[model samples]
Target: MFSCLKHKVGEVLLPGDEFSFQPEDTISLTDTVKPEKVICGPGLRRSGDRLLVSKSGVLRTKQPNMFWVDSQQKRYVPAKGETVIGIVTVKSGDVFKVDCGGSEQASLSYLAFEGATKRNRPNVQVGDLVFSQFVIANKDMEPELVCVDSSGRANGMGVFGGGGLLFRVSLGLIRRLLAPQSPLRAELQQLFPHELVIGMNGRLWVKASSVQQTLIIANLLESCENMTAEQRRQLFRRAAQGAL
Candidate 1:
């Protein structure tokens, strides 16, 4: 059953694609059988004894039984523990409403920040960009965002200062960019020195030595989503040659 799904990894699967688990052909009375468990992430769900694809995209898997789909989704879906870049839209009482490119705005508490207290609050204001993680997120309930970790440290999550440019990209591209030792990020770093903040909700913030350089990087990233790896390499080569 595990091998059935494992073999399909990296293949394009559409909605309604299903896989069923079956018992082994032979079992020995003296041998102990360990149950195999598989974890389904976004785009895959379990129904009865079968696994079903809920989205149309390429199947992806992580070691030790984790599976999901990498899709070209423009809209963001809030998920618990996902770090996202949100724009503060309203400040109401103790909670701030943040737009995370989702169906509804997520609520961020003033006390969610590091070192924040009733007497001394974090200097949050409307129109500020916050890098926060979702503490509570589900389809039936409103999403909640927090800037601090369980240890009460910001851990790189907090309000963004001025000067960086924020832009949108496909969610699939965002996943690729965030992958371990990502080739796209590696090539970009080779081009120039820059600061990049990648949000799971398809938002990216980039800053370079000059406004022109920042725009150049942003455009390159936005354009490469549909290009093949070789095509991206060719474009990077042109950029390295000062072709821009």
Candidate 2:
């Protein structure tokens, strides 16, 4: 029962001891006298008169559902329509390869660069950070990414420069730090006092008042991983409110 809540794979379930099933949820069950009934990864809960099961499984108690465990390996799975920040790593013919912190590299075409015209395509060099959306994840699981905005414009989608510092952190920490309600996020906003945060799956780009302020923000973001979700949210709120 205790192991299930921790999201560990291969945890065994006993009969009558209700366990939360799905991906990430707490397990609580009434101890049953019999041992024959047991299942894994299926939603189970008791109603007043009968046990209820959901085809989609249980609701994840974890704040962010972005994380998932598959085949006993922990990996970051990017969903379609999700906005992600990535860095350009290499260029090929008309496409640029980007590092999205996933197993396969994502591709952004030359035509997608801001201000690309029939005669003039903006030269986007390596190391430029771009905010993009997952356009396609083919059968092979390779992601095709794009950056065109709703109005069919590519402005505000490329090459972040100045006013901030960039740092690499673990993927898990990045997800926690980016939760909209995270306290750490709010605190970071206040401490640096600027707009426009671009968070990659593993890297962060922030704008600050000064270099010193940027360093402070980086340190704070790094420390947020060990904090609880609620605690992080509070800290972020305080930081955003200028308490940091």
Candidate 3:
């Protein structure tokens, strides 16, 4: 099978755009044609032999021919193995209910933490934020959270995001910030020194040098989510100059 991989990365694509498919539009007798196998990711659909974009955003592709539309969305869908920042709401007998901004509240076992037992319980209070991964997430079932990985290692996964600001943003922005080669991250770093925790569920935690700087950083980041590279660079440079 074959698929179209000719478009440049970070190309903005709107709804109804033909993202990738077998080039039935072009046929050459001398050229061999192969049946294409394209995985229609989010914001895309397959109609007959064609792939159609169903969301408004830039198109993104991974190696080995995986494609998806990166659209700005605030809703969170629980998915297994994805770490998220959640707020504790209820402390049950053993499990704590957390609101991870998903469709439903997730459950976190007190023993999910590393080196935690009934006698060695981790101190967690209501309204506190917990950075944990989804251990079980299915559409038909409530999601479950774990503070440690399958190997019983914390791997920097735990609670305690003291003295920081938490806010929400589009899911697309979070993905862009976490991207390995995103130019935005570099430009942002040049602006100031700050720490950021991005949750896949459209939530983020930020801590900067001071309150003013933190607010500036947060506003700047929110404004840059939908901008192009040149636009983001301009914004970041202006912020660095205290124009924010």
Candidate 4:
């Protein structure tokens, strides 16, 4: 068995593997093994007697690779049933425009707001934070968000005022943190007393006691990927207790 030390072909060295190259000797893996046999890296070719490698990062064989990171700051991906927090951007008759951190804005109907059909539609003005879900995302990836409940009831959903902080963050960081089952959620419940979080792929809206506390929560969410599970729990606990 040949052991590849590194991903590069030239860096690969076997126990007793030996090959000779003359003044202008060009040797390629294809000469000895079939193209299918060659693996790791990309763009393998034979030029004269020398094997040339292309800079393109493609491997002939299927190999586990790292996930792709977006060049932009961390953002959130709209999941089918994901519960998201958003801010009202516009109100037009029965519908409102919301910024969900994507190229296309989201649409929220007045019926989705709490008490829309009741006595009178609560004034959900611009900059009001709302907790909603991804109801529909078209084939073009345009999302239509909603705040209505399963029975089409509007409760525990709508614009949040007071005791909340809003800010922007990379979408990548949001996915790293904020799990439904994570201790952070419970800890936050105790910290803010009454908190609402809206995570857009590019931004975040949080409501907490103080700006300092909100910043701590944001830092914890951003560092979730680097902290251990135990550490994360501890961090959440401390933040809840106002230690962080």
Using TM-score, give the best candidate's number: 1
Q: Encode model 2's per-residue lDDT on 1-244: one tens digit a residue.
A: 3234445333433334334434335434775433223232234454443334332322233422221221211244565655677889997778899987777888887776556765786677888877787778654777978777656676566666655677766765665556779555555555556555555456677666777667657766777767777786776667557665
Cα lDDT for residue 132, candidate 3: 95
Candidate 3 overall Cα lDDT vs. reference? 0.84
| Candidate 2 off by > 4 Å | 1-75, 138-141, 229-244
> What lDDT, from 0 to 1, does candidate 4 have?
0.58
Residue range 100-124, candidate 3, lDDT tens digits = 9998999999999999988999999
TM-score on alpha carbons, each prediction: 0.96, 0.61, 0.83, 0.55
Instruction: Write model 1 residue lDDT over 1-244, tens digit each, in one string.
Output: 6989999999999999999999998987897888999999889989999999999988888888998887888999999999999999999999999999989999999999999999998898899999999999999999999999999999999999589899999988998999999999899999989999999999999999999999989999999999999999999999888898
- Please list the C-alpha lDDT of all candidates, in the order they appear: 0.93, 0.60, 0.84, 0.58
Query: How do the residues 138-195 of candidate 4 rate in per-residue lDDT, one tens digit apiece?
Result: 5476687777877877656666657656666555445434545645555556656545
Off by over 4 Å in 1: none
When 1 and 4 are scored with lDDT, the better candidate is 1
Which structure is stronger by TM-score: 1 or 4?
1
